[model samples]
Target chain A: MIRYSRRAVLKASAAFAGASTFAIPSIVHGESDRIRVGHLTPLTGFLGALGTYATLGMKLAVEEINQAGGIMGRQLDVMSEDSVNPATAATKAQRMLEQDGATVLLGEINSASALTVMQVAARNKKLFMQTGARSDALRGKNCNKYTFHTDIPNTVMVNAVGQSLLRDNMVKDKKFYTLTADYIFGHDLLAAAKRFFGANQGNLIGDELIATDVTDFSPYLLKIRQAKPDVVCSNLAGNQVTTLIKQYSEFGLPYPIVGFNLNTADAWAAGDGNLSGTWPTVWYHTLDVPASKAFVAGFLKKYGKPPENHAWIEYVAFKMMAQAMTDTKSTDTDKLIAYFEKETEFDILKARKAHFRAWDHQLMQEAYPFTVRPKGQANDQWDFIALGTAVPKAGEPLEQLAPTQEQNPCSL
Target chain B: MQFGFLLEQVVNGLVLGGYYLLISLGLSLIFSVGGIVNLAHGAFYALGAYGCVEITKYLGFGPAVVLSPIAVALLGILFERFILRRFYTADPILSLLVTFGLAMVAEQAIRIVWGAAPLSASIPPAFRGSVFLGDFLFSRYRLLILAVVAAVLLGVWLLLHKTSFGCVVRAGIQKPDMVAALGIRLQPYMTSIVMLGVGMAALGGAFFAPITIVHPAMGAEIITVAFVVVVIGGLGSFWGVVIAALLVGVVRGITIHFAPAAGEASIYVLMFLVLLVRPRGLLGERIEKFE
Candidate 1:
């Protein structure tokens, strides 16, 4: 072993101490070199298909932002964790804030987990961008000062579809047989559908709250056959959606189908092009806009498939956050929130710009009616659904699709 | 509800019962013959489904349907010789814990290989459309499921009751030491029984794969239902499991017609009621361990 002089030892110790002193704060606060973003989403489980796409969208945004000289000359770094459930989400949110020193938090497809993350964000005073959950409570009773919702909520989705139903002459005095999933998310969506149908003079002949695990939809299908409804409004989620669509097709029921919330991935999974219906969608891959085309190209280059709505929500969420941070020239949670509340517009790949409402922290974006092509008429595998312009007519104001200030009364 | 609808519900219940019968039969056999709670039974089912998917992609649906279960059964033999054989003499709880750990690893491995998204196999051309039976319409694929399961149940019965290998297996389950003292080795019989039980579970998975969503968590989803069927049927009794599975399927189907949300909940309620009345199960036999 070699022995060192006292002066050398002292100098070495000083250098080590100096290096650690500078490195520790950088890890916590993310100095001028990098900005830490904590991404909490389900990377595994039933909702994982959408979650994985959402993570990809986050990555795409982070890469583009870093390449374009990220917020205040600092690069963006995302630390992702699988938010499996509400309990896991709450603990991870706290750990992300305290242990990881994350300056911002994003993601959550499950509404219950989103609510938990929202509470954690409020308590920690960190800016949390809610990405995938579509519960109306997030914009109403559950809305908090710290959280900002980027996806379209249940009420907005219903209202958009309701308008389309009236315009397309599908809802006036029409009888509907509703098959709602038996869960909190399903209950909320059913409530929204009821409100829409009630307002539009639609009659519900049969209503069934189906358990999520119930694979065979035949019992309910037989009921629908007896009830003879005009259309069967499906408020189902997860694999339940695929099951219903497949079984319904197999049954050869003549009732027109309409879905409140249908993911792009669900359509793709219904192989042989079985899924077909007029659905209220937030965004489709086939939107004829520059941002959408560019996003589709870049996403295809990286992921080898067109981005789904979950991917769109996550990609748009990061871009919107980065825009706010750049505009304010700061990542301070309060300052950025204040800037967000001032009605800043974001180009979210739609024809019109989307912005956060001052009252509720909801993103006011364009909603469209999507119709899937028939199996015989399909061009490519992913070219299943196309945007319909009849219902939410071209150039229809986005404000009309969402609830007014009086309806929500959200006070942050 | 109309009488026609009620009749339709009965048919539906019977079809659902067929799946329960297929799944619980294998679990009951393994528990009784092997004396090890094979918690990885569902994982074997999942592997069978994934195997079917992979095999069908190249060999088409016909050959996949015939060969996937056999391939998974061979895998079960390897699993028994290497992993399960070590825990044979240990406490039953050790086997349960070990199988549970294996199940978790298998599910993760499936995710790593097949990805986390739900996948579905296209229904074969032969079973694509519906066939009308009298006034009611029924899925042709469902009819195929009922027929296959019925034949399988009959085959299992004949094998266990008529064959010499099955006789040795039964004797080993009841009196391993006595069977050994008779100048006969039971290790091969135990290995064969495990293979048969696991292969039966794989057949259930292979057939159900075309109808249901084949995902990673499918094993977790089916395991609880299998255990409940086993417990409610009186653990080791083969006919008890069959009767219980049928009862569960019919009750669930009927419950969906009356109260849609009560379909799954009613099964557990029935399980609880059965356990309360007879802790051993509906047809449970008092089991004696061979010293």
Candidate 2:
């Protein structure tokens, strides 16, 4: 399968040998004749680290693109907005379009906010590259021609996790129990997990939502005793994930606890080997590629610390957008869309192995299925890396996954 | 639940309840003498945990466990003089904000002192593992926690209810002018109460350090529960606080055994329901009426 995908990519790249043929169209409106991009980020939130990285990634890509002869002699200019909330993201999206006259909108780190930004793109006819947000619905019924996802959506994670579980023979005869965060990420992950397990060989016997009612894990600990499910899939974040793991250990609750949304730097360090062996799906692990390796080394050299998921995703998404702008050969919306479709392969450290999917406009790159097992750097929760398997290029048919109406009742 | 399981659940409830009683005992005592809410009560908890880490890192586990709270209380006096005194004359909400600020300051200070990662703490070498209790089993660490909390609660009960200083504090809460008229300076008593409440919160945090995480934000998460116990048991009622603690703990224990998803919300819900029926609370003999 890997060889086949590699050969197919080689053939396609050979077919489009002259990569510079698609240069940004000349600026007629007395503009700088450069590609102007907008970044929507959350400077303050639980996912703040990721938002910062998303912005930085765009900066790095723009810098690299401009340095390498300015994208057919037209440099990439970019600006970002702090899309910390829905209203702010909507405002930022509009400002990026009308005020800044941004040619493209880089999706926010938060999925709910990304969806809100997608609406703006559809109306304004601006290209949207979604890199961070993992909403499965964005590629489904909510799919618009203008919106493109560069990161693996939550459902893709489910497919990767489920497929890997099946491959490892780890999904049989187990009763799954979900300890999920009560939000879009949690709900979507749980739904995708259920679908994945059902198709393979497992049953979601019992589940619980950790939200308003659960300030402590004392009750959930007791239910674990009562139900005694074979697997506990928890979608907890930050300190809460560490809290649950510690409490579970204290109670001596013995069961394989898989982390569904445990994909952050803080959780990795805080878990202290307790969350190790728990499986999770993520877009890029810093240990996977040379670009990532170099980026991590550079980041650590600059900041005296290692990079995590936030930095890795930002690095990939920004570069992809820059490459897209350069390939389109024009700042014009109609021309850019044609350019994006034609330039299927994105050359970057993150997605150099694979090409971008044209169907959902989601990145058709490989996902490194990581388990939160022990032994890594200190004081960080991003201890997870590619454990045993590199899930090969399996083209995720985004639209093939059920639409928003089919998935979310309220979305319809 | 089975017969053995029910007993185990009760035991668990008692252990969980003991922490509430232990922490609230100090808050109640402090409230009786000093009017401030001591919002940084959880900070004391975190301090205890950090003290355990620092002391344990330097000294052995045994010495650290004994010395951590003493170190915290000694430091607590300084905090009382520097931070808490200013808030005394301010609005009650000001005390709330100041203490909340103090809690934030302490969290960051501790993080600055002990990085963002959680450190490993264990039950003192003497009390590791579990003992068989019929069909159920109890961790020695948990059993040790029970003994410690019980001993502290009894010690507090004696110090407050059975002593002259306790008598003055009790009088101060009900009739502060009378205590002042009796020629006893209120500052020393207020300082002691502040230290005592903070010390208890620290002890709970220290004991939990091995079992729960020893990070900065933990105190923020559990402070609401501490407040729940304070409100439900009546603002200044000692015995009321004790009963309320047990009720809250047992309810959590029982519910977790049944519906774990609602573990956190259950405590507040129960507190709300209690406040609705008995407007004063479980034991509010004479509260300053707000509503």
Q: What fnat does each of the candidate structures reach?
A: 0.37, 0.23
Candidate 2 lDDT at A360 equals 57
State the lDDT of candidate 1 residue by residue for A108-133, as single tens digits.
Answer: 98888899999999999999999999
Local distance difference test values of all predictions, in order: 0.82, 0.69
Write down the C-alpha DockQ for each prediction: 0.26, 0.16
* i-RMSD values for every candidate model: 7.6, 12.6
- Best-fitting candidate, measured by TM-score? 1
Model 1 steric clash pairs: none
Comparing to the true complex, what docking class would candidate 2 get?
Answer: incorrect
User: How well docked is model 2, in DockQ terms?
Assistant: 0.16
Best by DockQ: 1
Candidate 2 chain B, run of 10 with poorest lDDT: B282-291
Q: For candidate 1, what is the total of clashing residue pairs?
A: 0
